[model samples]
Target: MLFKESFSMAFTALLANKMRSLLTMLGIIIGVGAVIAMVSVGMGVKSDVVNSISSLGSNMLIVSPGSTNRGGVRGAAGSRTNLKYDDAKAIKEKIKNIDFVSPSVSRSYQIVYGNQNWNSSVMGVTPEYMSIRSLEVSTGSFVSESDNNKRNRVAVIGSTVATNLFGTTNPVGQNIRVNNQPFKVIGVLESKGQSSMGQDQDDVVIVPLTTAMERLMAMDYVSSVNIQVSDANKMDQVQEDIEVLLRQRHKIIGGKEDDFNVRNMTSLMETMSQTTTMLTILLGSIAGISLVVGGIGIMNIMMVSVTERTREIGIRKALGATFQNIMMQFLIESVVIGVIGGIIGIGMGCGLSMLVGKFGNFTTVITPLPVLVSFSFSVGIGLFFGIYPARKAAKLDPIEALRYE
Candidate 1:
């Protein structure tokens, strides 16, 4: 028979059982929908993580005192007080591919701005902290080199702090207490929204490291230092150099391990991406199982269809129809069922993906690749499931088929 005749016969057979075809399509529909929805959700999370980390800066590297341990039994090489102001200055002068450096001595204090009092974090950092952290000063000037040199008790407040304290009044050139020590207001930072850790980036205050260490915090040790590299390609070399220099500076001999650590934002991004990719693959595979089950349902229905048409087959063969025609006709019927179901599933998947994008509070974009992939896979499933039943019908004897009730 001609290919057109085969296809028409197959389509006609499927049309004879519209209800069964529709029910078989339902499984494929749900499977495809789940695949798109789950993958879109994973992609949304990954995009959020990448943008949030990138906001910290492109070539930003964090150097902390505890990082020297390299994830030993101590865990995470957490920051220690071994870092000092002189170490920060030395890193500034010594490291190659160096851009800007900020040594931070962080403290939490109960801040009183008029009648509104709140406990807030305060950081002792140099003016360079602004450039290293990509922080911007909105209302006033950032604390300058002269401010640090003179050990001036000047501070910069976040916008949240500004709203809480002075209302609409100009906070600059005013006095606020840091640990109840009077400090002149030098600058106010623009709102940074939040950090990757979900902490409010704008809920803190800033002051010259000198003033913080000497006056209010009253500590001799630095908690950690943030380092910005001039070249992204040179990060490894620079990290190695910083480790060697700090190790030597801290008076630790080689082979015994260093007392400090260096970190870059790239590693954090890699970790997040790896996790998301795995989740996407896992969800896709689980959704794929439903497609297999749907294919099995198609096969079961096709077998029953063959059995029901036994007398029809006997009459066709008695009329001199070849076994090849019989095989082709039933095979076409199975493919018809699969192809129609695939189209419906693709539509359902795309529609569901859009619904998720709209109401799920995440950006779930439907690309053409996944749609095509899913549809083609469904059609393949149809062919695979149709094979056994089509062969069984073709192998039936004309005598036995004619005798069927």
Candidate 2:
């Protein structure tokens, strides 16, 4: 019955000063709301990066030419013209658990069809490159083995390239010029949108590797080799095997540096996941500072309330109210403010997330974990900050409190 009376008195006190109570909770509301929104944004970015990496291909690995040491001075990575089409062929023939290997080279060129021209990247790849890169031909066919073998001047254009160069016209079977060299369009690729790095995936053209090396660029070496593993579980093993095979092929022995670099998509994805997770934690921590400030606000207000209610404390003590009763009342008041503020903040956070998702360029993914965590933290802050003020109010001397004007 005493506890009930104390709680009732606490509720009445808050209701009597509605504006002050609302102002007291304002800090907590902002803190919790910021935490939820920021965490959601971080999670969305992490999801985008993972999905972007996955879209490249399943169990994928890329091998590129390493740096070269010429005249005792090292050049940048991929400056060595060591990666060849034969290296890719050897991997497919000798390596086990390999699904497909596509050797590719790329260069930028101005594509022209009639009067419309657009500068776009042109890649030379085998037919297997389509499956490896998760590319789909929307119309007509992709580069065939015959095309690569015969070094035919046929091209497959991306959606962005198609839109810029041909507009609405069907580009398949139409003759176009790449860097003033005439080529026939064999297919148009489906739209892939933007990558995680904001690069337009559909702003390129593809031709046969042989044609790119011998005819267009006149370069015999490939820039990179993309390999797909048949089994996801064997990705690491396959990467190691490829490294070993390349070392033997390049005649590098006795701790000599490799002439080629191998990269595993799975490892890249894991590193990105860790980076985004840390970013999320960092954002949440920055927002949590507001909660601490709100707790301090609660403590300050409770201290003022204690000073204002000194005479009331005296009267309650004279009426046989215990120290525990006074402490309970102030604690309840702070807790009530925190609870209400936390609820409002959750609604505000969710609303903000929805609005951002609807209007913003990036996505926002609101999860229940952040909501629960923020709410619990707010309540904890309230309870913790209320202790000192509640203790001071409980310990007030009845005679001194009563004498104070």
Candidate 3:
């Protein structure tokens, strides 16, 4: 009953100064709202990165030619023509736990179909390349073994390339000119969208490895070799096996450095996830500074409120109200302000996240955890800030307070 009476008095006091109470709550509203929106953006980015990496394929590994140091001048990785189509064939033949291997040679080319022209990346790959990269054909078929062996002038277009060249017409079985060389269109790849690196995955064409090597690039060396392992758990073993096999084939004996670099996609995924988690925390911390500022505002206003009601405190004390009752009344008022602000802030934050996702062309996820944390933190801030003023109000001398103006 005493607690109820104290809460009733707190409600009445706040009602008497509605504008002042609202002003005090504004800080908390902004603070919680900003924190929520920022965290949502961070989480959304993390989710997108994971999905993008997964789209590349599971249990995947990439082997690229390592850099070479010539006369103390080091060139970048893939600057050396050390990796070849033969090396890729050797790995597939010798290694265990290997599902598929595709040696790739890529170059940018101008594709012409009828009067329409579009510039896109042209990749030389085998039929196994389709499954390794998780690429599905929307129509027709990918490069067959016969096409690769015969070095047929056949091509498989990506969704972006197809749209640019054929528009509404089906591109399958049509002839498109790549680098002015006539090639028959065999397939169109399903849309894979953009990668995490911001490169368009569906803005390219696939041709037979033999065709790319002999006709298009006129090069014998492959740019890289992509391998998909049979099992995710054997990735480490498979990577080691490939490294040893390559080193032996290249005859890098007696502690010599490898001429190739191997990368595991699973490891890359973990590293990216950790990086995104740290970024999310950093953003959330920056936004949380406002919550601290809001606490300060609440303390300042509560102090002023205590001073304004000093005479009222005296009258309550004279009427046999205890010091605990006086303190509880002021504390409840501050907490009420915090609770209301937190609710309003949560609503505003959700709306802001949705708007950002729609207008900014970015993903924003409003998880329940962040909302709960913000509300609980706001309540804590109110309790902490309300302490000093409540104590001061309780410690006031009844005689002195009664004599005041």
Candidate 4:
């Protein structure tokens, strides 16, 4: 028989049992839909994280105190107050690639303005902090070098703090008490929603580092230093330079670890991206199990089909149909079932992903790669499972088959 005739025979047979064919495809439909939805959600989360971190600044690096060993007990990173203001000053003056350096120290304090009182984080920083953090003042000005030098008691409040304390009133030029000590509000920062860690960025107040260390916390060490490099490509080199410089300043020799840690945003980006990619592959693999089950369903139904058409097979063989032609007919039927399932599965998967994004507050992106992969895999499953049934049908004895009831 010609290939076209075999295809026609297969099409007619499937059309006669439409219900069974659809039932066999159910597993494939569900598998494809689940895989697409889950992978899309993972990618969306990764994109959100990257965007949030990028919004903070460009080519940023963070330096914080490293762990301290107290007798054999080691503390967590930043547990030791080893990072100081002078370290930030030295990096700013000596580093050629660095654009700005902002030394910072933070503590929670009760802020009182008029009759309103709110407990919020108070940050001590320099004027360069505003640019390094991508923060802008809506009114008045940020802390200047003179403010840090004079140890002036001035505050810059975030939008959330401004709303909570001053309501609709212009907060700049107003006096707010920090830890019962009065400080004039010099600026109000623009609204920043939240960090990737889900912490509110607009729920704090800023002051000069000198004021925070000497007046508010009574501490001499800075909590961290935020650095912005001039070029993103040179961040790793700059980070190494900063590490060597800090290690020398701290007098660490040989293989001993330094007292401070340097973190570049590029490394963080790569780590986060890798994590999400792993999650996507994991989800897709789990969903693939259903495709195998669907293939088994096709095989089971094809076996039954061969049994039911035993007399037909006998008649065709007795009429001079070759073994190859009989095998081709059955194989065509199975592959048709798979191809139809794949097309429908693609449609269902895209629709399901969109629905999830709309109602589940998830981000979903349906790219062509997943669709192509799933469709090709489904067709392969059909061929793999169909071989046994097709061979069995072609091997039937014509004499016994014709005598069947």
Report lDDT per candidate: 0.81, 0.91, 0.91, 0.87
**lDDT-best of 1 and 4:** 4
Q: How well is each residue in 147-188 modelled by candidate 4, as lDDT tens digits?
A: 999999999999999999999999999999999999999899
Error of 1 at 381 (Å): 2.2
TM-score of each: 0.81, 0.91, 0.94, 0.83
lDDT for each residue of candidate 1 in 243-272, tens digit (9 for 90 to 100): 888888888895877677688777778899
Worst lDDT 10-window in candidate 1: 71-80
TM-score winner, 2 or 3: 3
Which sections of candidate 4 miss by over 4 Å? 1-12, 68-79, 112-117, 136-154, 162-177, 181-192, 316-328, 351-363, 395-401
Candidate 2 local distance difference test against the native:
0.91
User: What ranking emerges by TM-score with the best candidate at the front?
Assistant: 3, 2, 4, 1
lDDT of 1 at 393: 89
lDDT of 2 by residue, 210-315 (tens): 9999999988899999999999899999999999999989899997778888889989999999999999999999998999999999999999899998998898
Off by over 4 Å in 2: 2-9, 67-79, 351-360, 397-400
Q: How accurate is candidate 3 locally (lDDT)?
A: 0.91
Tell me the deviation in Å of residue 237 in model 2.
1.5
Which pairs clash in the backbone of model 2?
Answer: none
Residue 246 lDDT in candidate 2: 91
Candidate 4: worst 10 consecutive residues by lDDT?
Answer: 68-77
